[model samples]
Target chain A: MEKKQRKQSPQRPAFLKVLQKSGLSFLAMAPLLLGVIGLVGLFQVLVTPKMLTSLFQGNSLLDTLIGTMSGAIAAGNPIVSYLIGGELLEQGISLYAVSAFILSWVTLGFIQLPAEVEVFGGRFTLYRNILSFVFTMLIAVLTTLSLQGLS
Target chain B: MKKQDKPFAFRGKYLLLTVLILYGVIFLVSSQSVQLALLKSGTILVKILPIFGVVILFTSLLNFFIRPKQIAKHLGQDSGTKGWLWALAAGVISHGPMYAWYSLLEDLRSHGMKDELIVVFFASRAIKIPLLPMMIGYFGLTFTILLSFYILLGALLQGLCMQLLQTKKM
Candidate 1:
């Protein structure tokens, strides 16, 4: 019985080892997380909805392009994007523009690119971002058209 | 048991320092805005705390019970349609800031998860379950449902593109 109990001791240590590894991983992630939060805060204060809204000119193609660009640059919380999207719609910005903005806001992250590249490497990050950018435009158009059809 | 790389660790610290310095400079220009920014940042930190804890615990549990072989089998290069489904489901359910999941995804990648699945996961995050109500409130129910559907479709489309490109490379 004593030998059996002694053999089981290794299992407890294994779990402990996992916990330690996890703790270390979280510690290592601290700096990157803080930096991302700080950058997001700066963006929130620096870029206003009015600034983003003013850039839209009501042309479907141009506004979509601008909207995608703006969202990519000002990437942050989805909640914040919704607020800005609401404001833009109230200001008469077309759904095409607003949809593009909201979609890119969540998907593309020029600001977080460095952190992503750090974790996922350069090539993968580049491909993912570019694909996301293209899809944002495509989906935005489809979503708007679908909504129109549904209504 | 691999010694984690340390060379790039300093990069994270440098990024934080640079951003802090920027905050300091901006503080001098407008203290109120800086204060507001700090408050907002604090609020964000608070909101993510619980989620972060859960993530760390989940990651540890994953690392403990699931081996690299299992990860490869489920999310690996040959995981096929099942892998795509798994990535989409995980992305839809995941909450908190996307950056929080980066480390876990990186770990999974090292364990043989495909880049295509990773792209799928990232793209699928566009549909936030908790925030769906708010989205509907802002943009009618039909628009919300349609947008959600398109986002899922887009995610899979992006994943397909990534896989094609990766295969072409190999």
Candidate 2:
């Protein structure tokens, strides 16, 4: 009976060891996964026409630029993307600017940058970001013109 | 003596079998859409098998050829802005979903990389070299040029802002 009990105990520890290693990997991936799911849920809730209309009531190019910047500031949550995309389209915001805004809102999260800084070093991180920003605007302008041609 | 190993292996197989059976039962209780999604994901993976293989092979190459320590040595504190520039170029050529690249970023960070460079890595996803031909075909050369310039410029601005505003955080 003692031998049998000893065997049973070893089984538990062996199983537990496997569980522990896999568990840590899962934990590391959990935050980003949850963030994505939460963003999707948020996208379904707040992406409405009226909200965007109120957000971008003005016509100035500068206003559009500001709008994009604000979008970046509020970044994360795809719901914002849908809402802003709709509003920008309705408000006659240039496709170039709107595209840039959408891209930045997702790709460039200024609010999240601090968190990123905590993970990546400030200098290398900053230089990489500047390059990304440049690319974002470039894509936006190009997308805008192409969209114009289609229309 | 070799035969004794069979009992231990059998027990391992039994445990795996038990877990799989339990998973199937739980999956049955889940929504039908969840099942459909799994099926759909499998189908998509099959369709993209070649791309998937190439990407996986590339990822392995990155792991083998570009050790994080090497990247660190070039982009580490003493290496300065020049190191950062090369880091961005390397980031551009790399592939996979954002989440997949996190570990690599973690590796770089541990090797003394800055956060601003990490942000640049995230930002450079906009420039897909493989898709450039398609984009040019659809958007025209002028629009493509302007868009590429804008993205690069915006990324540069973002990096500078973060560097100036939060250098010590990382």
Candidate 3:
């Protein structure tokens, strides 16, 4: 078996070299990727945590409705949601608020607008994203209401 | 220089011009609050940098390891109900944002998967493997199951819609 495997390994290095080269490309892309991250971070800082707190302190349903809209505009990975979720929860935000925030964190979010628009076309992407946000909030509201009933 | 060696018109100079134009437009359109939010979230982005690197590396590795032909052989249209089931099953097991799956989906698309299956892959992302148990705790087992089923159903319907559009294009 060892001898047979050795016979078949002749072309392995040629292919492996490409994979090895991609590693350097990944490293080179790191700073550009990090710069994009910093840009997002700047957006978050500009928004101010105080504004975020006030947004969720309103009537639970309205908070969640608008939260969904806002979330669609600010999409990224779920870690952002968890951090923002924890903050909202700490500020006496309701379960509905947290739920909507979490859902929109993933389902909605405008961070992908440029890329999405590029792929799916500007009008289509905008409409679909808006529709997704609306549906998400609707689901959040229904889920919260249903949970309340169950309790 | 060989014909293939020549770059496309969209590359190099054209790309730079496009980027510069877009940046100027963005700067003009953005509000004060938007600018402040970017600054505030800058640290958060820095912290998540390592995780993004790992995720991208892992995704690329998975692409390297998982042969598209084999994936399609098991999950192609002729696989019938089982194919759809596996697409949803596989999607649930996958991680990262929906956008992360774009390349994989494009690969699968080339490998004979239908638009419906792609839709399922995108929509089924609502199910978080680690968080499902916690969701059950908060919303009850029945509710969780129902919602999951509903999402799958939505994906199926959306998939059919995409198929219809494709047929129209054809």
Candidate 4:
């Protein structure tokens, strides 16, 4: 019994150490997390659906740019993007615009920029966002063309 | 693990203070908007809290059990195709909001995970299993398949781009 107890004692301290480290990490992240949530909330209230939809002017390049920009600003869940994309498609918006919107809506995040920068570093965050934004436009155009070609 | 290169506490505090000041200004302009914003923020906080708990617990356990060498073996600079495959699979399986995953990624980075793999993980998150049905309903089966393929491809391409760019910087 003494041997077993001695063997187990090391793990107990390790577990406690883990717990303490986790707690500290959580506390460290709390303020930044709260700030991100606050910004998302403000965005939700300030950016309306009509305001987003009105920006697309039907020119493929222009609409694609507008879609990507708007989606980046209003980043949220993929589900919400699908709903918004569907609505836009039904409203006669080109697939290029909707595709770009959906892609950037899920990929790019302007509101979460600070939190991402804090976690990943500014250069990394900037490069990733820029690359993702550019890819979103490319993917949007390609997806639309592929669909058109198939149909 | 290497210590964080930059201190985050001061920046986080400043961010929080700025947000609070913004709220105060918005409140003065329109109390109703402020109220709505607070409620929305509260809702988001509630939603993310549980995920945050899971992330912290997972990271702590990982820190305790997984050595930096093991992480390096699987996801390090020399981890190769296997590492890319692992990152792609992990990214596809990951759920919840993007912010919730940042802490875990940071933990992994400390344990020697590559930055390119991190980009792959983020890019692959575009494909959500739970939301696939809804996506198909909206965009149809063929489009969904094509987009999913493109997203996976894009994830790899992006990761490669990041690796190249970082290498160039070095």
Candidate maximizing lDDT = 1
- What TM-score does the predicted chain A of each candidate obtain versus native chain A? 0.86, 0.59, 0.64, 0.86
lDDT of 2 by residue, A58-99 (tens): 554554565556555543333445456655666676665666
CA shift of B128, model 3, Å = 3.2
DockQ score for candidate 3: 0.21
lDDT of 1 at A77: 74
Question: What is candidate 1's lDDT per residue for A32-134, written digit by digit as tens?
Answer: 8888888888888888777887888978888898989999988567888899899988888889889999999989987788788878889999999999999
Better of 2 and 3 by TM-score: 3
Using TM-score as the measure, name the better of candidate 1 and candidate 3: 1
Model 4: pairs clashing at backbone N, Cα or C within 3 Å: none
Q: Report the Cα lDDT for residue B34, model 3.
A: 46
Model 2 misplacement above 4 A: A1-27, A41-55, A62-91, A109-151, B1-68, B80-82, B94-100, B130-140, B166-170
Per-candidate TM-score against the hidden true structure:
0.91, 0.51, 0.61, 0.92
List residue ranges in candidate 4 displaced over 4 A: A1-13, B1-11
lDDT of 1 by residue, B13-117 (tens): 877888899999999999998998888888888988888788778878877888778899999977878999999999999998788898789778888999999
**Candidate 3: misplaced stretches above 4 Å?**
A1-38, A56-61, A75-97, A119-131, B1-79, B97-101, B110-113, B131-170
Per-residue lDDT tens digits for candidate 2, residues B66-135, read: 5556666776666677866766675567554343355446645655676566665666555566656655
Instruction: Write the residue-wise lDDT of candidate 3 on A77-96 in tens digits.
Output: 55556567667766777767
C-alpha DockQ of every model: 0.61, 0.10, 0.21, 0.59
